[model samples]
Target: MSGIGVLREGPLHAAVKDLLARPGDVTEVKYGRYVIDLVRADGELVEVQTGGFSPLGPKLDALLDEHRMRIVHPVPAQRRIIRVDANGEVLSSRRSPLKGEVWDVFDRLVSFPSLLAHPNLTVEVLLCAEDHIRAPEAGRSRSGRRRRDPGERRLTEVVGSEVLASPADCAALLPDALRAEPFTTRELATAVGCRMILAQRIAYCLRGMEVLTDAGKRGRAPLHVIAA
Candidate 1:
Protein backbone atom coordinates (compact mmCIF):
# COMPACT_ATOMS: atom_id res chain seq x y z
CA MET A 1 0.00 0.00 0.00
CA SER A 2 1.14 3.55 -0.75
CA GLY A 3 2.06 5.58 2.32
CA ILE A 4 1.60 9.30 2.83
CA GLY A 5 4.72 11.47 2.86
CA VAL A 6 5.22 13.98 5.62
CA LEU A 7 5.87 17.50 4.41
CA ARG A 8 6.37 20.90 6.07
CA GLU A 9 3.15 22.40 7.39
CA GLY A 10 1.25 24.17 4.62
CA PRO A 11 -2.07 25.75 3.63
CA LEU A 12 -3.70 22.30 3.41
CA HIS A 13 -3.80 22.21 7.22
CA ALA A 14 -5.52 25.62 7.36
CA ALA A 15 -9.04 24.16 7.45
CA VAL A 16 -8.35 21.94 10.45
CA LYS A 17 -6.32 24.58 12.27
CA ASP A 18 -8.93 27.28 11.74
CA LEU A 19 -11.56 25.12 13.38
CA LEU A 20 -9.32 24.45 16.35
CA ALA A 21 -8.54 28.17 16.83
CA ARG A 22 -12.07 29.28 17.66
CA PRO A 23 -12.78 31.75 20.52
CA GLY A 24 -13.11 31.28 24.31
CA ASP A 25 -16.36 29.33 24.07
CA VAL A 26 -14.54 26.68 22.05
CA THR A 27 -12.05 24.28 23.62
CA GLU A 28 -10.19 21.14 22.57
CA VAL A 29 -10.65 18.08 24.77
CA LYS A 30 -8.93 14.71 24.90
CA TYR A 31 -10.87 11.62 25.89
CA GLY A 32 -9.26 8.17 25.84
CA ARG A 33 -7.14 8.07 22.67
CA TYR A 34 -9.29 10.55 20.71
CA VAL A 35 -9.18 14.32 20.56
CA ILE A 36 -12.56 16.03 20.41
CA ASP A 37 -12.80 19.52 18.95
CA LEU A 38 -15.50 21.26 20.95
CA VAL A 39 -17.31 24.58 20.77
CA ARG A 40 -20.39 26.29 22.20
CA ALA A 41 -22.63 27.97 19.67
CA ASP A 42 -25.97 29.54 20.56
CA GLY A 43 -25.74 27.78 23.96
CA GLU A 44 -25.23 24.33 22.36
CA LEU A 45 -22.07 22.23 22.62
CA VAL A 46 -20.68 21.21 19.24
CA GLU A 47 -18.18 18.38 18.75
CA VAL A 48 -16.23 17.56 15.59
CA GLN A 49 -14.66 14.17 14.93
CA THR A 50 -12.95 12.81 11.86
CA GLY A 51 -11.57 9.45 10.64
CA GLY A 52 -13.32 6.05 10.47
CA PHE A 53 -16.58 5.18 12.25
CA SER A 54 -15.58 1.85 13.83
CA PRO A 55 -13.81 3.19 16.94
CA LEU A 56 -15.13 6.75 16.86
CA GLY A 57 -18.76 5.70 16.57
CA PRO A 58 -18.93 3.67 19.77
CA LYS A 59 -16.99 6.30 21.75
CA LEU A 60 -19.18 9.14 20.45
CA ASP A 61 -22.34 7.16 21.26
CA ALA A 62 -21.10 6.51 24.81
CA LEU A 63 -20.25 10.22 25.24
CA LEU A 64 -23.67 11.18 23.93
CA ASP A 65 -25.37 8.81 26.35
CA GLU A 66 -23.39 10.28 29.24
CA HIS A 67 -23.60 13.97 28.23
CA ARG A 68 -26.79 13.70 26.12
CA MET A 69 -25.26 15.83 23.36
CA ARG A 70 -26.58 15.39 19.83
CA ILE A 71 -24.26 13.38 17.56
CA VAL A 72 -23.42 13.81 13.88
CA HIS A 73 -21.46 11.33 11.81
CA PRO A 74 -19.96 12.33 8.45
CA VAL A 75 -19.29 9.12 6.60
CA PRO A 76 -18.18 8.30 3.08
CA ALA A 77 -20.93 7.81 0.46
CA GLN A 78 -20.30 4.07 0.31
CA ARG A 79 -21.07 3.75 4.07
CA ARG A 80 -24.56 3.84 5.53
CA ILE A 81 -25.56 4.62 9.12
CA ILE A 82 -25.99 1.36 11.05
CA ARG A 83 -27.42 2.71 14.29
CA VAL A 84 -27.90 5.61 16.75
CA ASP A 85 -29.28 5.45 20.29
CA ALA A 86 -29.06 6.82 23.86
CA ASN A 87 -28.91 3.33 25.41
CA GLY A 88 -27.90 -0.01 23.87
CA GLU A 89 -31.15 -0.10 21.86
CA VAL A 90 -30.95 1.60 18.45
CA LEU A 91 -32.83 4.88 17.92
CA SER A 92 -32.29 4.98 14.16
CA SER A 93 -30.43 3.13 11.38
CA ARG A 94 -30.40 3.19 7.56
CA ARG A 95 -28.55 4.24 4.42
CA SER A 96 -28.13 7.98 4.30
CA PRO A 97 -30.63 9.75 2.05
CA LEU A 98 -27.97 12.38 1.19
CA LYS A 99 -25.73 11.42 -1.72
CA GLY A 100 -23.63 13.79 -3.87
CA GLU A 101 -23.25 17.46 -2.79
CA VAL A 102 -20.12 16.97 -0.62
CA TRP A 103 -20.10 20.57 0.59
CA ASP A 104 -23.51 20.20 2.24
CA VAL A 105 -22.26 17.16 4.18
CA PHE A 106 -19.03 18.91 5.24
CA ASP A 107 -20.93 21.97 6.46
CA ARG A 108 -23.12 19.84 8.70
CA LEU A 109 -20.16 17.83 9.98
CA VAL A 110 -18.20 20.97 10.89
CA SER A 111 -21.19 22.43 12.75
CA PHE A 112 -21.59 19.34 14.99
CA PRO A 113 -19.11 20.47 17.68
CA SER A 114 -21.25 23.46 18.67
CA LEU A 115 -24.51 21.55 18.29
CA LEU A 116 -23.44 18.78 20.69
CA ALA A 117 -22.29 21.26 23.32
CA HIS A 118 -25.71 22.92 23.53
CA PRO A 119 -27.73 22.10 26.64
CA ASN A 120 -30.78 21.40 24.50
CA LEU A 121 -28.86 20.13 21.45
CA THR A 122 -30.42 17.66 19.09
CA VAL A 123 -28.28 14.94 17.42
CA GLU A 124 -27.74 15.11 13.69
CA VAL A 125 -25.94 12.87 11.17
CA LEU A 126 -24.06 14.37 8.23
CA LEU A 127 -23.02 11.73 5.73
CA CYS A 128 -20.29 12.82 3.30
CA ALA A 129 -20.16 11.45 -0.24
CA GLU A 130 -16.94 9.95 -1.49
CA ASP A 131 -14.65 12.19 -3.50
CA HIS A 132 -14.04 11.29 -7.16
CA ILE A 133 -17.24 9.25 -7.40
CA ARG A 134 -17.05 7.74 -10.86
CA ALA A 135 -19.90 8.26 -13.28
CA PRO A 136 -21.20 4.99 -14.70
CA GLU A 137 -20.08 4.34 -18.25
CA ALA A 138 -22.78 4.18 -20.93
CA GLY A 139 -23.63 0.58 -21.80
CA ARG A 140 -22.73 -0.70 -25.24
CA SER A 141 -25.21 -2.47 -27.49
CA ARG A 142 -24.49 -5.49 -29.73
CA SER A 143 -24.43 -3.12 -32.70
CA GLY A 144 -21.62 -1.09 -31.00
CA ARG A 145 -23.82 1.90 -30.22
CA ARG A 146 -24.08 3.39 -26.70
CA ARG A 147 -27.19 2.39 -24.73
CA ARG A 148 -28.73 4.22 -21.77
CA ASP A 149 -29.34 2.31 -18.55
CA PRO A 150 -31.73 4.14 -16.22
CA GLY A 151 -30.91 1.97 -13.24
CA GLU A 152 -27.17 2.66 -13.59
CA ARG A 153 -27.64 6.40 -14.04
CA ARG A 154 -26.52 8.48 -11.09
CA LEU A 155 -29.03 10.75 -9.33
CA THR A 156 -26.53 13.62 -9.46
CA GLU A 157 -24.77 14.91 -12.58
CA VAL A 158 -21.15 16.07 -12.40
CA VAL A 159 -20.41 19.32 -14.21
CA GLY A 160 -17.13 21.06 -15.01
CA SER A 161 -16.65 24.05 -12.73
CA GLU A 162 -13.21 25.77 -12.83
CA VAL A 163 -10.08 24.88 -14.68
CA LEU A 164 -7.52 23.03 -12.55
CA ALA A 165 -4.81 25.37 -13.84
CA SER A 166 -4.71 29.04 -14.76
CA PRO A 167 -4.00 30.10 -18.35
CA ALA A 168 -0.26 30.52 -17.69
CA ASP A 169 -0.13 27.13 -15.96
CA CYS A 170 -2.04 25.53 -18.81
CA ALA A 171 0.30 27.05 -21.38
CA ALA A 172 3.36 25.83 -19.47
CA LEU A 173 1.98 22.29 -19.23
CA LEU A 174 0.95 21.97 -22.93
CA PRO A 175 2.86 19.55 -25.15
CA ASP A 176 5.29 21.01 -27.71
CA ALA A 177 3.07 19.98 -30.63
CA LEU A 178 0.03 21.71 -29.13
CA ARG A 179 2.11 24.70 -27.89
CA ALA A 180 3.34 25.43 -31.44
CA GLU A 181 -0.18 25.24 -32.91
CA PRO A 182 -3.80 25.27 -31.80
CA PHE A 183 -5.02 21.84 -30.64
CA THR A 184 -8.36 20.05 -30.87
CA THR A 185 -10.55 19.43 -27.80
CA ARG A 186 -9.66 15.69 -27.87
CA GLU A 187 -5.91 16.43 -27.79
CA LEU A 188 -6.32 18.93 -24.94
CA ALA A 189 -8.47 16.51 -22.98
CA THR A 190 -5.85 13.76 -23.34
CA ALA A 191 -3.12 16.11 -22.14
CA VAL A 192 -5.17 17.47 -19.22
CA GLY A 193 -6.52 14.17 -17.80
CA CYS A 194 -10.19 15.08 -18.30
CA ARG A 195 -13.17 14.15 -20.47
CA MET A 196 -13.62 15.78 -23.90
CA ILE A 197 -16.73 17.57 -22.65
CA LEU A 198 -14.80 18.98 -19.68
CA ALA A 199 -11.96 20.04 -21.99
CA GLN A 200 -14.47 21.83 -24.21
CA ARG A 201 -15.95 23.63 -21.20
CA ILE A 202 -12.46 24.69 -20.03
CA ALA A 203 -11.60 25.92 -23.55
CA TYR A 204 -14.84 27.90 -23.71
CA CYS A 205 -14.23 29.47 -20.29
CA LEU A 206 -10.59 30.31 -21.14
CA ARG A 207 -11.65 31.83 -24.48
CA GLY A 208 -14.30 33.92 -22.69
CA MET A 209 -11.68 35.05 -20.17
CA GLU A 210 -9.37 36.14 -23.03
CA VAL A 211 -6.76 33.62 -21.87
CA LEU A 212 -7.24 31.40 -24.94
CA THR A 213 -8.10 32.22 -28.56
CA ASP A 214 -10.56 30.04 -30.46
CA ALA A 215 -8.90 29.27 -33.80
CA GLY A 216 -12.09 28.27 -35.62
CA LYS A 217 -13.21 24.66 -36.33
CA ARG A 218 -11.17 21.84 -37.86
CA GLY A 219 -14.00 19.82 -39.46
CA ARG A 220 -16.36 19.06 -36.51
CA ALA A 221 -13.64 19.61 -33.85
CA PRO A 222 -12.88 23.03 -32.39
CA LEU A 223 -9.31 24.36 -32.00
CA HIS A 224 -7.87 26.46 -29.19
CA VAL A 225 -4.55 28.26 -28.35
CA ILE A 226 -3.11 30.62 -25.75
CA ALA A 227 -4.01 34.24 -26.50
CA ALA A 228 -1.08 36.41 -27.68
Candidate 2:
Protein backbone atom coordinates (compact mmCIF):
# COMPACT_ATOMS: atom_id res chain seq x y z
CA MET A 1 0.00 0.00 0.00
CA SER A 2 2.96 2.32 0.13
CA GLY A 3 3.06 2.87 -3.62
CA ILE A 4 0.93 2.39 -6.74
CA GLY A 5 3.21 -0.47 -7.76
CA VAL A 6 1.58 -2.63 -5.08
CA LEU A 7 -1.48 -2.93 -7.31
CA ARG A 8 0.54 -4.95 -9.82
CA GLU A 9 2.84 -7.04 -7.63
CA GLY A 10 1.95 -10.10 -5.57
CA PRO A 11 0.84 -9.61 -1.97
CA LEU A 12 4.03 -11.02 -0.44
CA HIS A 13 6.38 -9.08 -2.70
CA ALA A 14 4.58 -5.79 -2.12
CA ALA A 15 4.49 -6.34 1.63
CA VAL A 16 8.23 -6.95 1.88
CA LYS A 17 8.96 -3.96 -0.37
CA ASP A 18 6.95 -1.69 1.87
CA LEU A 19 8.59 -3.15 4.96
CA LEU A 20 12.02 -2.25 3.53
CA ALA A 21 11.10 1.24 2.35
CA ARG A 22 12.75 4.16 4.06
CA PRO A 23 11.85 7.87 4.18
CA GLY A 24 13.49 8.86 0.88
CA ASP A 25 13.38 5.49 -0.85
CA VAL A 26 11.84 5.36 -4.31
CA THR A 27 9.50 2.46 -5.07
CA GLU A 28 9.13 0.73 -8.44
CA VAL A 29 11.39 3.14 -10.22
CA LYS A 30 13.03 2.66 -13.61
CA TYR A 31 16.80 3.01 -13.75
CA GLY A 32 19.44 2.01 -16.30
CA ARG A 33 16.83 0.39 -18.58
CA TYR A 34 15.47 -1.87 -15.79
CA VAL A 35 12.65 -1.44 -13.36
CA ILE A 36 14.04 -1.88 -9.87
CA ASP A 37 11.85 -2.52 -6.85
CA LEU A 38 13.30 0.28 -4.73
CA VAL A 39 16.24 2.65 -4.57
CA ARG A 40 17.49 4.48 -1.50
CA ALA A 41 18.32 8.18 -1.56
CA ASP A 42 22.02 7.35 -1.61
CA GLY A 43 21.42 5.24 -4.77
CA GLU A 44 21.52 1.77 -3.25
CA LEU A 45 19.44 -0.74 -5.19
CA VAL A 46 17.07 -3.10 -3.38
CA GLU A 47 15.60 -6.11 -5.11
CA VAL A 48 12.92 -8.24 -3.47
CA GLN A 49 12.98 -11.52 -5.37
CA THR A 50 10.64 -14.27 -4.17
CA GLY A 51 11.50 -16.85 -6.82
CA GLY A 52 14.51 -18.41 -8.56
CA PHE A 53 17.64 -16.31 -9.02
CA SER A 54 17.98 -17.30 -12.68
CA PRO A 55 15.93 -14.42 -14.04
CA LEU A 56 17.79 -11.85 -11.95
CA GLY A 57 21.17 -13.01 -13.22
CA PRO A 58 21.32 -10.64 -16.18
CA LYS A 59 20.11 -7.69 -14.13
CA LEU A 60 22.88 -8.19 -11.60
CA ASP A 61 25.41 -8.57 -14.38
CA ALA A 62 24.18 -5.33 -15.84
CA LEU A 63 24.13 -3.23 -12.67
CA LEU A 64 26.63 -4.67 -10.20
CA ASP A 65 29.49 -2.96 -11.97
CA GLU A 66 28.22 0.51 -11.00
CA HIS A 67 25.99 0.11 -7.94
CA ARG A 68 25.66 -1.54 -4.56
CA MET A 69 22.76 -4.01 -4.59
CA ARG A 70 20.99 -5.95 -1.89
CA ILE A 71 18.85 -8.88 -2.90
CA VAL A 72 16.17 -9.78 -0.33
CA HIS A 73 14.78 -13.29 -0.57
CA PRO A 74 12.14 -14.32 1.94
CA VAL A 75 11.96 -17.78 3.42
CA PRO A 76 8.81 -18.54 5.32
CA ALA A 77 9.94 -20.02 8.62
CA GLN A 78 6.34 -20.75 9.60
CA ARG A 79 3.25 -21.02 7.43
CA ARG A 80 -0.47 -21.09 8.23
CA ILE A 81 -2.66 -22.72 5.59
CA ILE A 82 -5.80 -20.71 5.01
CA ARG A 83 -8.57 -22.18 2.87
CA VAL A 84 -11.18 -19.86 1.40
CA ASP A 85 -14.20 -20.37 -0.79
CA ALA A 86 -14.84 -18.84 -4.22
CA ASN A 87 -16.92 -16.19 -2.49
CA GLY A 88 -13.90 -15.06 -0.48
CA GLU A 89 -15.14 -16.50 2.81
CA VAL A 90 -12.57 -18.22 4.99
CA LEU A 91 -13.37 -21.93 5.43
CA SER A 92 -10.59 -23.38 7.53
CA SER A 93 -7.13 -22.61 8.81
CA ARG A 94 -4.31 -24.87 9.92
CA ARG A 95 -0.57 -24.71 10.62
CA SER A 96 1.91 -26.33 8.28
CA PRO A 97 4.27 -28.86 9.82
CA LEU A 98 7.14 -27.88 7.52
CA LYS A 99 9.62 -25.21 8.58
CA GLY A 100 12.18 -23.21 6.58
CA GLU A 101 15.78 -22.34 7.38
CA VAL A 102 18.31 -19.81 6.12
CA TRP A 103 20.11 -22.53 4.17
CA ASP A 104 17.18 -22.68 1.79
CA VAL A 105 18.72 -19.76 -0.09
CA PHE A 106 21.20 -22.11 -1.72
CA ASP A 107 18.32 -23.66 -3.65
CA ARG A 108 17.93 -20.35 -5.45
CA LEU A 109 21.55 -19.24 -5.42
CA VAL A 110 22.58 -22.14 -7.61
CA SER A 111 21.48 -20.02 -10.53
CA PHE A 112 24.33 -17.60 -9.86
CA PRO A 113 26.76 -19.24 -7.46
CA SER A 114 29.72 -17.01 -8.30
CA LEU A 115 27.76 -13.84 -7.63
CA LEU A 116 28.55 -14.10 -3.92
CA ALA A 117 32.13 -13.12 -4.71
CA HIS A 118 31.01 -9.78 -6.10
CA PRO A 119 32.06 -6.96 -3.83
CA ASN A 120 28.94 -4.87 -4.42
CA LEU A 121 26.38 -7.60 -3.81
CA THR A 122 24.68 -8.66 -0.59
CA VAL A 123 22.19 -11.49 -0.28
CA GLU A 124 19.87 -11.33 2.74
CA VAL A 125 17.69 -14.26 3.71
CA LEU A 126 14.54 -12.85 5.28
CA LEU A 127 12.75 -15.27 7.56
CA CYS A 128 9.08 -14.62 8.13
CA ALA A 129 5.68 -16.15 8.98
CA GLU A 130 2.97 -15.97 6.32
CA ASP A 131 -0.45 -17.17 5.30
CA HIS A 132 -0.52 -19.74 2.47
CA ILE A 133 -3.94 -19.06 1.00
CA ARG A 134 -5.83 -21.57 -1.14
CA ALA A 135 -9.08 -21.20 -3.04
CA PRO A 136 -11.28 -23.52 -5.10
CA GLU A 137 -10.55 -23.72 -8.81
CA ALA A 138 -13.31 -22.81 -11.26
CA GLY A 139 -14.00 -26.20 -12.83
CA ARG A 140 -14.43 -29.78 -11.64
CA SER A 141 -11.80 -32.46 -11.90
CA ARG A 142 -12.00 -36.10 -13.10
CA SER A 143 -13.92 -37.08 -9.94
CA GLY A 144 -16.37 -34.18 -10.36
CA ARG A 145 -14.84 -32.52 -7.33
CA ARG A 146 -13.33 -29.06 -7.31
CA ARG A 147 -9.61 -28.72 -6.68
CA ARG A 148 -7.98 -26.08 -4.52
CA ASP A 149 -5.28 -23.94 -6.11
CA PRO A 150 -2.68 -22.04 -4.18
CA GLY A 151 -3.22 -18.26 -4.07
CA GLU A 152 -0.98 -15.44 -3.01
CA ARG A 153 1.03 -15.59 0.18
CA ARG A 154 0.16 -12.91 2.74
CA LEU A 155 2.87 -11.73 5.09
CA THR A 156 2.14 -12.03 8.81
CA GLU A 157 5.36 -11.18 10.65
CA VAL A 158 9.09 -11.04 10.05
CA VAL A 159 11.00 -13.28 12.45
CA GLY A 160 14.67 -12.99 11.57
CA SER A 161 17.29 -12.53 8.81
CA GLU A 162 20.72 -13.78 7.71
CA VAL A 163 23.16 -11.70 5.69
CA LEU A 164 25.56 -13.35 3.26
CA ALA A 165 27.99 -10.63 2.25
CA SER A 166 31.09 -12.60 1.32
CA PRO A 167 32.50 -15.96 0.39
CA ALA A 168 33.55 -16.46 4.02
CA ASP A 169 29.93 -16.01 5.02
CA CYS A 170 29.04 -18.75 2.57
CA ALA A 171 31.74 -20.99 4.01
CA ALA A 172 30.42 -20.43 7.53
CA LEU A 173 27.22 -22.15 6.52
CA LEU A 174 29.10 -25.46 6.80
CA PRO A 175 29.37 -27.09 10.19
CA ASP A 176 32.68 -27.14 12.09
CA ALA A 177 33.03 -30.88 11.65
CA LEU A 178 33.37 -30.52 7.88
CA ARG A 179 35.87 -27.66 8.10
CA ALA A 180 38.97 -29.66 9.05
CA GLU A 181 38.45 -32.76 6.91
CA PRO A 182 37.77 -33.62 3.30
CA PHE A 183 34.14 -34.70 2.92
CA THR A 184 31.62 -35.90 0.36
CA THR A 185 28.21 -34.41 -0.25
CA ARG A 186 26.64 -37.24 1.74
CA GLU A 187 28.78 -36.45 4.75
CA LEU A 188 28.04 -32.76 4.33
CA ALA A 189 24.33 -33.60 4.30
CA THR A 190 24.55 -35.41 7.63
CA ALA A 191 26.63 -32.66 9.19
CA VAL A 192 24.13 -29.95 8.19
CA GLY A 193 21.00 -32.03 8.84
CA CYS A 194 19.75 -31.43 5.29
CA ARG A 195 18.99 -33.55 2.25
CA MET A 196 21.73 -34.62 -0.15
CA ILE A 197 20.40 -32.22 -2.81
CA LEU A 198 20.53 -29.23 -0.47
CA ALA A 199 23.97 -30.18 0.70
CA GLN A 200 25.13 -30.47 -2.90
CA ARG A 201 23.81 -27.00 -3.63
CA ILE A 202 25.66 -25.56 -0.64
CA ALA A 203 28.85 -27.21 -1.84
CA TYR A 204 28.25 -26.06 -5.40
CA CYS A 205 27.89 -22.47 -4.29
CA LEU A 206 30.87 -22.64 -1.95
CA ARG A 207 33.08 -24.13 -4.63
CA GLY A 208 31.96 -21.53 -7.13
CA MET A 209 32.89 -18.82 -4.64
CA GLU A 210 36.39 -20.34 -4.25
CA VAL A 211 35.76 -21.35 -0.62
CA LEU A 212 36.18 -25.08 -1.38
CA THR A 213 38.03 -27.19 -3.91
CA ASP A 214 38.31 -30.80 -4.99
CA ALA A 215 40.66 -32.93 -2.89
CA GLY A 216 40.59 -36.26 -4.75
CA LYS A 217 37.82 -38.75 -3.82
CA ARG A 218 36.62 -40.89 -0.96
CA GLY A 219 35.61 -44.07 -2.81
CA ARG A 220 33.37 -43.17 -5.75
CA ALA A 221 32.09 -39.90 -4.30
CA PRO A 222 34.29 -36.89 -5.01
CA LEU A 223 35.89 -35.31 -1.95
CA HIS A 224 35.97 -31.58 -1.15
CA VAL A 225 38.35 -29.71 1.08
CA ILE A 226 38.17 -26.23 2.54
CA ALA A 227 40.23 -23.87 0.45
CA ALA A 228 43.48 -22.61 1.99
Specify the highest-TM-score model's number.
Answer: 2
User: How well is each residue in 144-181 modelled by candidate 2, as lDDT tens digits?
Assistant: 98766868798999999999999999888778999888
- RMSD, every candidate, angstroms: 18.3, 2.8
Global Cα lDDT for candidate 2: 0.89
Off by over 4 Å in 2: 1-6, 136-148
Q: Count the backbone clashes (under 3 Å) in each candidate.
A: 13, 0
Model 1 Cα lDDT, one tens digit per residue, 1-228: 111211322221223324334465444445565444454443334543333223445556546554534333333444334332334344444455554322222233232322223344343333333222122445698999987432211112122111212235334445666677888879877776555665665565455445577798899977887777
Candidate 1 lowest-lDDT run of ten: 152-161
